[model samples]
Target chain A: MNVFKLNSWSPYVAGGMVGILICLSVLITGKYFGASTTFVRSAGLIEKVFAPERVEKMDYFVKKKVRIDWQWMFVVGVFFGSLLSSRISGDYRKTALPPMWETRFGPNRARRWVIAFVGGIIAMFGARMAGG
Target chain B: MNLLFWGLVTGIFFGFLLQKGQVLRYDKQLGALRLSDFTIVKFMLSTVIVAMVGIYFLHDFGLVALKPKTTALGANIIGGLIFGAGWGLLGYCPATAVGALGEGRWDSLFGIIGMLFGAAIYAEVYPALKTNVLAWGNLGKITLPGVLGINHWIVIVVLIIAFCSLFYWFEKKGV
Candidate 1:
């Protein structure tokens, strides 16, 4: 049997599969799915490791400081899942940057770096305001 | 063993699908924005329908606990708009960005990092905004079936028809 490559599935097909996966998640675990929480938790862990006082005082970080394993496992699963998908599809490429990005953003890499940092800040701010 | 675990698993699966759909590609996402490719719309529509149906059933059966009622209508709409803009700019949402990064696309790393930063900022500033910015409106859990006074099943059927018609129209338009 031929397995479908990462790019082989049509959008609808892949979406439906994802939808089913969502259903499975609900059935098996009974929770809504999200990604930002993992990152927030990781940030908490970083703070805990280097600056315990900061982690303890910050309301946002404090809540996530406990039970670090659960969030870490989930984050690890996501990272590995993506890696496995890429490997199986024969589409894995290891580089700090893509060629098109380098060409478009320029050789300094400063533009991309600055945009990413600002963008990350804005995204996290929005999530917290929304109570996520 | 509980809902949180399932949530994580579901997230990982969504990451996988994002990779499979090539949605992590900047070109594909940009193409969708241009209306040259209907992939994003199609995919989102299908997923929303599935989620809606699932939620409806779960509520109907008392299989899951619903969130306590909150009436932050202004926040929901504003947050949704901001999120949509971010999605367009980044070419990937929080979930897919992880998958993209997993595929070794450095740009996705930026996207994920951006999301984390955004969430953190929100947390720090939420108290100040909660009173003013979040108090613009208070429409609590408005649903089509509730507003229309129709049976849940009927509402679901109507939505299915409407979505299918939209899909057909888009297909006809050669998108």
Candidate 2:
């Protein structure tokens, strides 16, 4: 095994573990796990505060929307959990581009930033079109 | 018990696993897209099986209400296709995107932002698309066994066996 490659748990083991966690989610929360909903709810809350009419009028935001309290907290937890894990595992690195990527992509921060933004838009649109 | 709390826990677990699986690496995801690796398929199948079995048993024992809604086939197919495309292009699904962020992959941050933007845009334009896109069809929460006219447990068992078989084959083929 390449210890220097990166830290990764076995896929089967990780899948089974996540599967059990999802089972717990269903049992305790009565909801299937989803990440998109949180983002939508947060956006709704933003709209609700600044542009109530728009949020209310939007078909996607009008139904089954979560309040800010729960949705934002959940997103925050994701960030924190990841940060903690990286810290403990000694795998945390702050470089924007990996070494191999730097060689291939030429360390063009501007290009990376633009790609990231456009990619975000395309991905988001695609996800929504897919019923998220 | 709240959706948010559970979502958080799920997010953490997802991130941990992604890191552990080395899936945060862009190359691994690209490999899966190229069909050279079965890691993603195996992971997804196992997840569905676990969820299906767990939900079935929970509902069966009256521990939870089985609100088995009809599966919206059109939506599912279209949604799945788009989702798969996004998975291929961005190398992260909604859940795994969060996991990627957790593992400190900067690209995942873009993916997450894109997901949020896409969702928000959908919300903004939902009214215009409601009649056509949203109401195009309705299969209504249909499950595998429900459509097949077989016992639910049998369906679950068969699916598990099939998945295991596929896993076995993949392992043997070393793909």
DockQ of each: 0.46, 0.48
Model 2 misplacement above 4 A: A1-6, A48-50, A69-72, A98-106, B1-7, B67-70
TM-score, chain B, each candidate? 0.82, 0.84
Q: What CAPRI grade goes to candidate 1? A: acceptable
> lDDT, candidate 1, residue B8?
55
Question: Model 1, which residues run further than 4 Å from truth?
Answer: A61-75, A94-109, B1-9, B58-62, B65-71
The alpha-carbon root-mean-square deviation between model 1 and the true structure, to one decimal in Å, is 3.3
Candidate 2: lDDT over CA atoms? 0.67
Model 2 TM-score relative to the real fold: 0.84
Summarize candidate 1's per-residue lDDT along B1-175 as a digit string, tens digits: 4544644565566667767776766556666777787877778777767866887787788876544335576776677666656666566666666776788877778777777667656646655776787787877766667778988779887887898798898889978
Query: What's the C-alpha lDDT at position B150 in model 2?
Result: 88
Across B1-175, the per-residue lDDT of candidate 2 in tens digits comes to 4665666666666566656655565556666777887787777787777877887888888775565644555555666676666666566666556656666677767767776677788776767766666566777777668789889999888889999999999899998
- Assess the local accuracy of residue B50 in candidate 2 as a C-alpha lDDT between 0 and 100: 81
